[model samples]
Target: MPFYSSDSDDHRTPPVKMFGRQRPLHAVFGGGRVADVLLWRNKNLSAAILIGAALIWFLFEVVEYTFLTLLCHISITTMLVVFIWSNGAELFNWSHPKIPEIILSQSAFQEVATTFHVKLNQFLLILYDIACGKDLTLFLLAIASLWILSVIGTYFSSLNLLYFGFVGIAILPVLYERYENHVDYLASKGNRDMKKLYKKFDSKVLNKIPRGPVKEKKFK
Candidate 1:
């Protein structure tokens, strides 16, 4: 008798992995059309999106095209094509071109706005805490993060960073999902090593540092 049955009715819960990501990749990405595109489950759609993004980025960064110019060109081209097609259809007694209706959902916009509002407030609160010197760890971490970003900004233009970010977002998730086990293993090992190093440094250096008596702030 096996400890665990491999029958259709097993219903055994899976062991949780790193970062508490127990759900399938699709579920983790919301299990929707967008998730499908992002995870490359719909390879054609994903490739088209990536290629289109690359083309736009190239035009903006490499060709030095401004947003206003691009918008104007696109609008002019679309108007010319529609006008000619509508007039030609009337003259030729052909069926009218059926333009697809683009409907923007209010709920989707509200959801996005709400999420942004919450995240922005949270970020502001964190910044306030850091500025007030509430936590030394968080303050140092924030400084380090900003300093790193500043260094990166010096080397890369804003457009270059955006393009790189888009490319990474499109590619990295699928790659991670494909080699999730290997990635998790490496990440776990790296995390343990980092913890050990931090502990060693804290004991040897941070623990030896002399501290001055702190003066408590008086509330009015």
Candidate 2:
């Protein structure tokens, strides 16, 4: 009988993650501090973010406040407080409130801009592919997704959707991380079922459909 060393097991590579993810969840979410915040490792920061989002949602949805009105009100209140403080400090010979200077780095701005540019290009490519009718399944999926979104848009205002998205971001990631094994198992099973159904549909219905020679346009 061969004896395996205990240290050898520890040295083995980690098993592949769910949803065909090559990296761990932390790395997939860009790793480091961002992942920590998302996973609620920084509890204080995460709670603060949720509280802020809740306040915004309450202001817009419950209070029926317009964004412009809220902005102006906040600006006026801030200015009034600062104005009073600045003058009162002069009269009492008290120290003025220290306002920290904010500076935006050029490199940070460029990085953000580049990321958006890349994402925008990727979105445009997806739309182009869907429009080109190359993949029937992809085109149908896109159409169905857009139609569902359109229906959802009719029921909820943009602000409501934004708030809901924020709430989902705050909740879903943490829950998923905690129950990742069960979630991944269900997701994989569902995906396999979907593929089987798609294969059947393709063979039964799609194969019978007549097609014309598709003209592929070269993109410059």
Candidate 3:
């Protein structure tokens, strides 16, 4: 009478959680091998990549051709788009929209300008809110990230760096989801170690310091 299967086959234990989520397809990574080490999350991988990128930026004289090379790539992309549009127009018997006309259209320009203006205003408001201490740590970190990016941007093309960042953003969360348990274990271990270090420092260093003059029972 039960709707569900009563056989032992239907009640087998589920696969282990990867990262922090239930097993995703990629989590079937042939356990306990080099593939696990290479594909799964590793803390040192980040540091290694950053050092490598910096070395390549300098060794290849990336600064000299960064913008020039970017322009060449953009030129090629523009040609490909134009080619596709021209062919599509002929095949579909559609009128070719003149680029100059589109650029000069008052309504089109106004709509584009309005959208940009609204977005810029919203961004500025969020920045002002952060400056007012909505989240000082987040604001400071964002500024630091921008400063580092500007320095790196001088030596590397912006598009390549931007694309890398976008790819990391899109991919890292899926990876973490797929290996959730492993990631959480590493994080908890790090937290415990840091807490022990801080406690040791507090006891051995902070406790040795005499109370400063400001704390010496401030006489009225």
lDDT scores of the candidates, listed in order: 0.77, 0.76, 0.57
Any idea how many clashes model 1 has? Answer: 0
Instruction: Using TM-score, give the best candidate's number.
Output: 1
Q: Write one digit per residue (lDDT tens) for candidate 1, span 93-163.
A: 97877899988788766655765576588669878978898855556667999999899999999999988
Query: Which tens-of-lDDT digit does each residue in 12-37 have in candidate 3?
Result: 42223332344543333322222233
| Residue 175's lDDT in candidate 3 | 78
Q: Is candidate 1 or candidate 3 better by lDDT?
A: 1
Among all windows of 10 consecutive residues in model 2, the one with the lowest summed lDDT is 1-10
Ranking by lDDT: 1, 2, 3
Clashing pairs in 2: none
TM-score per candidate, in order? 0.70, 0.69, 0.35
Off by over 4 Å in 3: 1-158, 213-220
Candidate 1 global TM-score? 0.70
Model 2 ranges off by over 4 Å:
1-19, 89-94, 105-139, 208-220
Clashes of 3: 9
User: Worst lDDT window (10 residues) for model 3?
Assistant: 1-10
Quick one: ranking by TM-score, best first?
1, 2, 3
